[model samples]
Target: MGNLKGVALSLLFTSFVLHLPFAESDWFINYHIHVTNDLPLLKSPPNQPNLFLHCKSKNKDLGERGMVKGQDYTWDTKVNFLRTTLFFCKARWVGHKTRSFDAFVTDRDEMPCRHYHNSCMWSVRDDGIYFSKNNATWGNVYPW
Candidate 1:
């Protein structure tokens, strides 16, 4: 009985140690967006015309503001560790009226950024948006 108990405890300790690396490597997905002036819309109005990128998960808002035309903005937040959490990103412009574009939805499990250097890039265009692990080619298409 003493030998059996010792064997069980040893197995348990080995299992815990084997999982340490995965536990310590908890990674956060970094999200990035580049908004371009496809259309020569005049600069935001003096009333502080609002143009920004909004990212939201189940319980957190990882949004950014003051997005200028032809500029890029990037931000990161803790990866959703709960039940399959759905997150979305959109470019919003608030002036006399409100307009949103290039809306996309993804979950941590489905985000390629998680596997590819923990980063993702998005290009916001008037027609739609495209995503890539690298910023060079627009491979994944997301509807506007």
Candidate 2:
């Protein structure tokens, strides 16, 4: 009985430590097979204010794979390769400081908007669009 208790304690501690950093981070990557269609909100004015992008994948198992914080909205950055078109609502005009926007990744063959439904919500910030130098319209998002 004593040995079993020790093993359980160790497992619990290990899990907690592993997820600590991820919980505190601001963003994560999406590698699911359900989201394929991208919904764009609004494009930045020609070249005025700085642009930013935030994405989230409902599939917690897939895990994030790129920059999770301090995004400056650069066109030649590495995030443009994800190829997942994001959906933005009217409220996305808020900015990237707030933690309101989120996204999920899926393939063309899987359910496109099954997780988020026909409409996507915003948290009063521009934290929903996937910042890239490619197309301006959010249509079908492809994986990097």
Candidate 3:
């Protein structure tokens, strides 16, 4: 009985030490994905319709949302342990056209997002889609 207890205690101690969380791999940082509506809302014949958006990752769905001009939608998440995180979004203007784009990918966004205070911003305009990591300089990434 004494020998069995010693063996059990040693096994438990080893498992406990092995399971302890590591500072590096177990650490987490929050990242934000933001989308804005730059196009006109519903109005006259020449005006655009309310922008509808749906965004999702492998683990999360942001549910469809409608936006007026200058409105923004934002969500925060932590990059997964395996580093395969990705988020994509679809946009539509009622009477106009529809578009889809990748909003975030761990491989592409990890460095810039970490460098830019962990945020990615996107703008949907009449002409095209724009992206900015630091939220200052913007470039057209996709066209409608």
TM-score ranking, best first: 3, 1, 2
Candidate 1 scores a C-alpha RMSD against the true structure in Å of 5.8
lDDT of 3 by residue, 1-144 (tens): 999999999999888767755334423878888899988656764344378999999778999987878889899877776667889999987788899998998778777776678888899988888989888988899889
**lDDT-better candidate, 1 vs 3:** 3
Could you give candidate 1's per-residue lDDT for residues 14-45 as a string of tens digits? 89867653443454444443344232254645
Q: What is the C-alpha RMSD of each candidate to the true structure, in Å?
A: 5.8, 13.9, 5.3
CA lDDT of each prediction against the hidden true structure: 0.52, 0.31, 0.83
Task: State the local distance difference test value for candidate 2.
Answer: 0.31
Q: For model 2, how does the per-residue alpha-carbon lDDT over 1-144 read when each residue is reduced to its tens digit?
A: 999999999999889767653332212333222212222332554233332333433322233222222322211111122334443211122233322333422233113322333222211223243322122324322222
- TM-score of the candidate numbered 2? 0.19
Question: What TM-score would every model get versus the actual structure?
Answer: 0.53, 0.19, 0.76
